[model samples]
Every structure is written in C-alpha cells, then in structure tokens.
Target: MTTTIEILNPTFARVSGQELRKAPFPRLEEGTKVRIGFLNNQKPNTQELLALVESGLREHYQVESRTFFKGDAAHPAPPEVIEELSRFADVAVLATAD
Candidate 1:
C-alpha cells in the first residue's frame, strides 16, 4: 500500500496604490469660525478648568462654547446629552479634576 500528502497555498487580495497614499491635511482660511464643546464630568473644580479654556479660546480664535453639561456622579452622560453636544459644537472637551 502507498500513502500521498497534499499541500495548499494561501492567497491574498492586492491593495491599490491610491489607497496606500496618505490623505492631505484640510485647508483652513482666515476668519473661519470654530465651535468648542466643554463637558463637566461632575468632578471638583470642573468650573475653573472650563473658565480657563473659555478664556483661552476667546483670546486665541473665533470660538464659542456651551455651558458644561453636568453628568451624574455614578453614571456617564446619557445618549441625549451626547447628541445635544454633538449637535451644538464641532469638537468637545470632557474634563475631570483630581
């Protein structure tokens, strides 16, 4: 009696050259408005940090920020709160004080 063994080769899909190229940075012009969102994670001194950030933004750029949304001490911000923040601001900053 005789025995035989078989081997299989692995196959891979090829990627396009365009897909491997890095994306260009977005162009920014002067006087463009910027929106900033601040979230208070119910930590101590949260207000102070927010104040500092607000002042810095005002001095540096055309910026606007909404009041800190207070989250529960034991729980994170609800979906509604997150949705509200996303709608109101372009970017958000969540803070916690030690």
Candidate 2:
C-alpha cells in the first residue's frame, strides 16, 4: 500500500511590480523629548510587549508613550485613531505579539 500526503502553504506574496516608497523621518535634536505612539494590533500579549518597550524607552530617554487599540488585528486602524496619534506622537509603533 502507498500513502500520499499534501502540504499547504499559508503565505502571502506581493504579485505587483510596483515599488514601495516612503519619506524619511526627520532626525531629532539632542535633548529633545520624544513622544511615541503605540498602535496595538489587538493580538495576544501585544499590550504587554508595548508596555515593556515603553518602560525601556522611559528609562533611557525622555519619552512619552500613548497607546491606542485598533479593534481588529486583521483590519486597518480607523482614520481618526491615526490622526489622533499623528497629532500627539513624534513616532509611532504598531506591535503584534502573538
């Protein structure tokens, strides 16, 4: 008797040829206080991970952090949430910890 097995791939690839572009963020001056915005992906342990990062930043630099939940990890964040973060933070971090 012979047995057959099938393997499935659950990976995503970019099929388009268009290259991505992004503007470089400005450098911060020395002694400047930094405000970091955290976008939680609503995944397991994502909040804990962000908390640790926030703690580290606060210990080493003059940092302020604000966290916003994105409701669903599989969807994009709401425009209002992005706008609020943009107004309050100099840099943003979107974390996903499963």
Q: lDDT: which candidate is best? A: 2
TM-score of each: 0.61, 0.70
Per-residue alpha-carbon lDDT of candidate 1 for residues 1-98, written as tens digits (9 for 90 to 100): 89988766456556565557664433434445668778887667777778898887677667778865756655777888888887987667854546
Give the root-mean-square deviation of each candidate in angstroms: 8.9, 5.8
Q: Please list all clashing residue pairs in model 1, or write none if there are none.
A: none
lDDT of every model, 2 decimals: 0.71, 0.83
- Candidate 2: RMSD to truth: 5.8
lDDT by residue (1-98, candidate 2, tens digit) is 99988766568576798778895564776556899999999787888888999888777668888999898998888989999998998888955645
How far out, in Å, is residue 79 in model 2?
Answer: 0.7
| Model 1's TM-score against the true structure | 0.61
Candidate with top TM-score is 2
